[model samples]
Target: MRRDATSSARARIGAALLLLLSGSVVAAGEGDWPAFGRDPSNGHHSPLTTIDRSNVARLRPTWIFQSGVTGYFQAEPVIVEGVMYVSTTGNHVAALDAKTGRVLWTYTHKARTEKIFGPPSNRGVAVSEGLVFEATMDGRVIALDAKTGRLVWDQEAVRPEEGETETASALAATLGDKPVQGSSRLGFKMPPLVAEGLVIVGVTGAGYGLHVEDEKGGLDGGSVVGIEGGYGRRGWLAAYDAKTGAERWRWYVTKEDGWEGVFAETTPDGIPLNRDIAAEKAAAEKNRDAWKVGGGSLWMTPAYDPALGLIFLGTGNPAPQNFGLTRPGDNLYTMSLVALDVRTGQLRWHFQQVPHEQWGYDVASPPFLVEATTPDGQVKAVAQASKTGFIYLHERTTGRLLARSEPLITHKNLFAPPSPEGTVVSPGPLGAISWHPVAYDAVSNRAFAQVRHGAATYTIKTVPASGNRPELRYTETSEAKGEPTFSTLTAIDLASGKAVWSKKAGSRLSGGTLSTAGGLVFSGEEDGHLDAHDAGTGEILWRFQCGAGIGGPPVTYAVDGRQYVAVAAGGASFTKASGFGTGDALVVFALPD
Candidate 1:
């Protein structure tokens, strides 16, 4: 059918307006978890209340699908239509019938067998327009046909450099040159986000491999000598054409120019940074080009605000992680919540939670968008729970601080510098809130965060350059001490910036949390139990043993009118270090069918 030019133009305009409006609305439905935080805002909240507090206790395991590939299972299952998409360890993705947990199809990638950093794990997948997108641990972004699980396209997002390879080999060589120990140590660990016909994903591990200890010495399970050096790669986030795997734009997390930033003595909110600015300035001239390999890995899926046309995400610590003697200054965007233009990949604004971060306090979790009321009035706001044990709220548009919640966990020797003699620091490295996603309940204007309490011995050793070594080096080590580790689930009232209630746990918390209108908050533990708590008050309402530690985020979706809660039950490195059983299962729960 041929149409008039004027009519076609009007139709196009109308469609554009519809899309703009839809983007502005919080359009997440009760029946689907289409993306990693269940929506663009990363709220991790659902409106379904069918299985409220009164009936939540009646919930039981309705279906359990075993992936049979064990390691750290941390993928949060995403549901679109009636199908649930999950990515397992080794970058294996699967589509399952939401109601029955029947495997529809599976697509396994022949990931690189070479040395890699971190574990063979993925956070989750994104579903949009009949396509499923996954960012693999081996540095590839793949799209799959939504229904059939057929490969649509694959693009390599990060290419390994010779320096990175050498670093990986060096780290592994200490462990008897084991191939598994030396696998390519750089890639993506978080899910990919599909937005405005673009697949947005970031790479991690750029700040890794600086120091690795064998478990034989009570590290690496006392199996291998710790290897430490000034070895790391640059980190970046890139956008790709969703339909065609073509690169659109790329943004390096560490900038070449102006990487030092304004060497402010205090943070944006006026907290004393405790930095030796004079010493940093003196060292800047000699290390002018350090930003090239200065690590600032992106480790979480981003949150998008269509109304603002901005995408928000957090970056990891600077390179050499705990040993930041080479890279000085604020480190610009590292350890910050950065907002960028969705289409152009241009920086809009950033709020650095930790400037010149020495504490391994990377902003590892996803930023959540919410409407917050301030002293002036209600405004668009974004919130992120930090490893430093606070939920920071900011005015989304201007990046102004609205408020910061009270510390949810203990904080000791927070900014203490590493000394030759070990210094004990609480909430060391692993964080009060690790990469686990926090759940927000709009009904109560509260954010639920999983908090961990543990201490580590921080020590520094200076290695003098010798015959083969080219330069002097500093090695920083953080060893976990038996100072009684524990966890807490706390609900902070964002409006008031206060913790309404907190519940303590025996083991450190692993996975994330899901708050529903059912007056319940679902979360998992290092142990193999998934528990439901009363939303208003932190009370354990119900619990289930999934046979493995639930070290991934919990999600909820509806099939027809039935409500189901799902989580990946496989032990993670953290859980295993703390002595927990591991398995590979995606367990789904529901009220009596």
Candidate 2:
């Protein structure tokens, strides 16, 4: 059954109060990871020190839960009142006993017959007001009874427009090819965010479609291809009444007009954008309606600030992925950290990390909120581990640049444009820091990030379309070729804006970082090993080899006074592309009782 409206409101109020009291935005307690990032702050930090550095080596596998279905298991399990909720690759959600990893119940959404873009993956789920909320691959937000896993309410977040299917079918018939996938490749890969009596979620794939991959079957050096006419879709973030799942308000990532804002010559932080302003302005007149399908997908959950009533989230790359000749001008809101009013969904402010992006550099990671001591004394700020290989710190309220840590990885031809031949760029489209969450330690005023050190060759090609418009098409191929890729854990001091310490790992780091008051930082490797590092220094203190790659963030929670660290160990596309095997286990570690 759905939670009562009054009770839900009260719960939200209580959660807000707890956030203010604890100086944390996540409503998590010492024993629970109730939401992604373990709270609204996206701190990914635990207060429990029982499993501190001194005894982390003694940690052993307490239990393992295997979900028979497997494919990119990136779900970060949320534990509420000792019942853990996890979503599998196929949108199968299961409630498990937090203590023993025993399954309590499971709910699976019916599979979609239509082809879907991107990988079959789910990041995680949200728990609030006695309901477990999940965003399905088919564009549905479902509320399940937390205790029994029974269905409560199923809300169609985005319904296909009338004749939309017929339009695609007719287009396919005209071209004598498969039906052209519309912008509504609508689905939710991100974990849901519940706050202010609203279940907040966003849709992805607006900027994705059929891509031509190399013989290796990897996207690293691939080119995106699409139908002749405007093929991309608009991306949106919305809020719904939690109790009844009714629509509240929606914010489209793409602006109707002026999306090509002022044809800025440089980024907000004064980085040369290498744009052709005059050419973009000339092209803008011909492609005046480009904003209709302007792509700006939201890839992760937002970090909420209760006191400020603002929510912060990062946006994906603009539509058409790498082909920028058609869509000219700075793609406002895309590749940005946007702050919105939680109650009204109104844009408060935004800081674009990249302007007029043509490099496929999406700000894919979640933003972490921290209180840093700036030149103006202590102030609340939000930090994002960017794909550009810098930790960007912004003043939360005013959206001011506080500090940006030095590049955490290699920087070669940072924003070189694609050419007919090819241009090599380090920190390729996969990012120096991908979609994984980073950990913030307030005690040490340091942020820990896992980054990749690799590069890709981008080559551009033009093709002719067969549609009525018959417009010339521009496409780019991204081929992986460079030094052997490796991973690193860098500790950035928020105050000094410098790397305090760094540690390298042999394999790529697919998962995220977890810091605790226990003086430890934890991350998962593509090699299937979870390593514990000293929070202050970058020393590997403990390591555990799971059966498969750990592609999700490591979360720490407690049940019955026993501290436990858990992570989803399933293979990811990056792992497979990098020659690492995958697994399908939820491995829990705890100090031996």
Candidate 3:
């Protein structure tokens, strides 16, 4: 009403500038399968049950997107918005339309020349903000625009640096001294995890550096930048700024020679040891890197609990795993579930399953956080089925042991005493549950897990040392020792901590498990059949023999209000022991509509 006031108008303009300049935009809250388990909870259960069991039999393949990345397609496709992301051996990532399976974008990372041991198999992708992330075999973390398949940044996750702590084999003559060879190398592999503005990544192999002797012991320490703080370059956890991809913090499992005294303060004097075994052990471990020799590979995607601000991850089997005698002690963090505070990347607690596991039974599967109604009331806890023939349940908040189950009859090595803490334990080499994802039923408050019941034998052999050789090396071989050769689906009741029912499957190579509101649980048989079972009674409801074999987890989603069941029928790769051929397919099903 008054005459034009320039000062008032200028004030309004200033306010607008402040808002624009701040530019602190909030991230979108839309629900999508950003990571392997959908969310940090590792609850593979999705609310998008549009494709219920009612019409699942009538479902048909709407489309198919060949990844061109062959081998074990163990990866669970992740859908963000409408785009689906998956990976395979070597480093092949393809983005597709969730509805039509149409390829939108694809990225391929070069494989290493010596891509031996295990075939390149990636579980899935992780998304934060607008970037989709992947870790490559050649040791790099790549960031790509989720909407578009464009490279934003990549980093050398590991490298062989001068004087960096490492492990190696030397000539027989040099065995008397330290492990110093004329030449050296380094390596690492494992997908990076993004949480709370930090890109948390783990190294699978040797930390880049030489295994030179330090006062504390063997190559006492190397440079491990970021989380899991340690001196050596190997087996470290690194944190980087999510936006800039810059290093923030680092941690390692070992420290440098001078840091040897650090353990005296923490070691227990009551335990009998030969001299300063704790400090000596620390010194030797300073150079123990797994990537170079294929030891503890962090192959699976980790689970995050946003509410508790913690990250839950499972680690792989120990190196030269076939020979438990060479590497003693419960390898801290190996074949175990580790709880780390999300913000600081500090280790809160760890639970080891198979110490000194000889059969390569790694705790590599995802750990599920189930919120269920117990007999007394309700509780939240961590549930996991290990390859070591046990289903472990722990209080999520305190890592308190609650319950565990030995689902299968297994044999212990009569030759060996109870395995030292970290060596190895196993029902099978991979696991009672490996990379296969399990499903939880909210209605029943039960967790359904598929496990391969059998035993594998392992023995180590000594290899000739041409260059630098560590104290000793081991060779291992494994096969199904004894078994009915049948897989089983177990319904674990969270409240009573008991297996309500367990049904033997037709094949020992069942994929993962899926639960539907239609009172059904679906699993793909190793014998090339997809069977629907009554979730409550564990009775077979229906069976369909797809043309190919089923080796991937089944997913249920709805299209046009019709519930459809989907699963990748590509047979198992990576392991030849399965004797299964590769069958490329993504089978879909719907009830008789």
TM-score of each: 0.91, 0.91, 0.73
Model 3 lDDT tens row, 1-593: 12223432442343233222322122212224445554555655544443435544454555555655445555566655556677655567777766667778888776544422234455556676788777665556678887787888877665424213233322223336533322122233344567777777765543221223322332212111110112122245667777777777765532222222222212121212223345436544643443233245564556666667777777665543444333444445556677888778787877666544445566666788776454556677787767756667777777766766644445454123222232222354545677677787655678888877655444333445444543344333334344434578888776676778888887665567877555678877765678877778888767787645576667665544444466666665333334456655665565445
Off by over 4 Å in 1: 1-29, 160-184, 210-230, 470-472, 480-482, 574-576
Cα lDDT tens digits for candidate 1, 265-317: 87776767678888889888887877877778888888888778888999998
Which regions in candidate 2 have their CA more than 4 angstroms from the true location? 1-27, 112-114, 160-184, 221-229, 464-471, 574-576
Q: Against the true structure, whose lDDT is highest?
A: 2
Ranking by lDDT: 2, 1, 3
> Which pairs clash in the backbone of model 2?
25-40, 26-39, 26-40, 221-478, 221-479
Model 2 poorest 10 in a row by lDDT = 162-171
Candidate 3 residue runs with Cα over 4 Å from true position: 1-32, 48-50, 112-117, 160-192, 205-233, 251-295, 372-377, 412-426, 460-475, 480-483, 542-551, 559-564, 587-593
lDDT of each: 0.78, 0.78, 0.55
Of the two candidates 2 and 3, the one with more favorable lDDT, higher being better, is: 2
How does model 2 score by TM-score? 0.91
